[model samples]
Target chain A: MNTHRPWKLSVAGWAALLLFAPATVLAHQEIGQITGFASGFLHPISGFDHVLAMVAVGLWGAVLGSPAIWVLPVAFPVTMAFGGLMGLLGVPLPGIEIGIAASAIVLGIMVLAQLRPPLWAAAILVAFFAIFHGYAHGKELPEGASALLYSFGFVVATGLLHLVGILLGEAHRWAVGRQAVRAAGGGVALAGLFFLWQAVAA
Target chain B: MRRAVGTTLVALAAIVVASPAHAHLVETGFGAFYDGIAHFAVSLADMLIVIALALFAGLRGTRAARHAMFALPAAWLVGGALGALWPTASIWPVSTTLSLALTGALVALDAKLSDASVTAFVIVAGALYGFVNGATMTPGGAGGLALLGAVCAIFFVNTILAAEVTVLPVGWPRIAVRVAGSWIAATGMLMLGWLARPTLA
Candidate 1:
């Protein structure tokens, strides 16, 4: 039990750092011609809000147990693609940035509270947020880029982030680790609050 | 476990280490083959369905996986044939979305359907995928090569997924697969809503 303390602390500390780390501005255009697979893959991972929300979705799913472990992660990219399509077609969904920030806040709070809503409820929550995330991805797509390849890259990146969350969330299997996960959730929620403030303030 | 991990590592390495010339050049002959592969690789809707079907086959265990290995490609070929005969209309995006949703739900539920039922599902899935592929792809001089490439690519992906998942240690890893299934289903449902949403008048 004593030996496990370090492992637990490390996990929690990492989650805290990830959530609370000062935001870095990514120069998507400066990256230059994000036209191929590599660029698309990097896009989702590039944004701090996207990363937090995606990871939170995974962490929350892990905490929920059973089917959700897969469901939330899977729904995100699919719905995001839909949103991306909307963006591509020039369809309007207002306040996309607000929605993206709200996702982190809301999902982070869900984890922090250790809330386990019904499966359908959870799906709805994530799906609503996914559109914004996907739309943002679509909106950023380079002119004349291979839409398919770009989407593939971002989806893969998004999946990897969810995987990270699941791996972190799996810590809940241990009694001591459960609290650690909750603490991580608190960190995520705090990050979300900061993001929300920024969104609103802007 | 080591073997599965090794296979994945090898595949990733192959992708990373491959020459750029092997990827971007669109030419005749081999280029058409590459084009075919690229088409399937990037078609999100199709890829999702293939993945869902593979996941479903994996959840069903090895027997279903075996059946899927044969049935999916054969049905795809049949679908292609039908498409060649009357390549009139493409399948609706909604249909593909529905298929993905169904496959995901099946995996999430972990229902113990009969092998025949599973095979039928795979057949339908294959044919549907085939029909779409055939309708969209222009069968030029390299059409056969393109078809072969697409089939091979799909086969490779599905096989890896089904094989690795079939061997996963039960408990946490297995539960993770089911969770993935649920996500697929949720995505499908949301896509349906997106499709149905009324546009600004």
Candidate 2:
């Protein structure tokens, strides 16, 4: 490989730039404190970890096909609401961060492996992670927050991500699309590994 | 060369450092108007009704479907005005669910209603949803804006559905539309079952 060819050299340079960037900085950027409906909506989207895990759930659901397509998405938000409520009520659950990280890793692998668990099992898997995600939000809920409105914001955001997953997973209906979906799974799995590393290191 | 390298490094740092750890509920300056739209958007029941209505209109074809586009907005606005002005003490609580079931069933059957019948269905559906929206609206400017947003959403959704269905050719795509109707109907029935469970218990 000619290191000096313009396109190749630029690609190498870009790869180097990514590799050299500090994990902390590469992981997330601070956008200052946001609150209210926008805050709730932005919450899931802002975090790389949350985005990876939630999208992974959708991708897996799509891959699993019918019933699961709708089932997982529905189960997640409802169960997540329950988790959020638990947080609001000051109920304690252990290893919430670990669980969240594990979600990304496990769900990513599930997509990567093309696992087709029974619909109930898949629902249970995503629903379990949704709690921690919800709890994280619930615990940090702003003072004087309207529970109803805040819940609405996050639920919509989560739903949109799932929709993305389902839409992308629809690619499976095509041969080329199948490979792309699997590649996306691999990418998510890699991100999950990164999150796991970050979690363990912390 | 050194300066270019520095610039690249700076950009990369900016990207990495800007990421946040997790989502939290934060303030949005949108206020009640956005809230109304948000409420409508997230209301699964409301959306389901709109989708079913749209699917029905699409199946009904051009002349019949146009009635829905016209009648629905007019009725919705009229009903909204009534609800806002009179401020009903209680609404038909099951109206939404029932609307879903009725429309879903219609879609599932892929029934071809007479133009008048289709017109009647559109008006009734429009009035019911609009009334709900109006009743939910807060007083004054925000309320007015909210009503506007609701009408826009409803009009937009109905227009899109009615238009798209007319254009969709017969075959698998059309069949898929009917299948969607079946799913919507199934969901409504499931909801009804849940609602009925309390009585059964």
For residues B156-183, could you state the per-residue lDDT of candidate 1 as single tens digits?
8888898888898888787767767765
Candidates' C-alpha lDDT:
0.75, 0.71
Q: Model 1, range A1-202, lDDT digits (tens) per residue?
A: 4675565555555544444333333322322234656777788888998999999999999999877877788777767767876765568889888898889888988888899999999988998999998888766766544444455566668888999998999998998888888888888778877887888888
Candidate 2 CAPRI level: incorrect
Summarize candidate 2's per-residue lDDT along B111-169 as a digit string, tens digits.
Answer: 98987898899889878877876776644344766776777777788899889998999
Model 2 chain B TM at 0.83
- DockQ in order: 0.06, 0.05
TM-score of chain A of 2: 0.79
TM-score of chain B of each: 0.81, 0.83
C-alpha displacement of A31 in model 1, angstroms? Answer: 18
TM-score of 1: 0.63
iRMS per model, in Å, is 16.1, 11.4
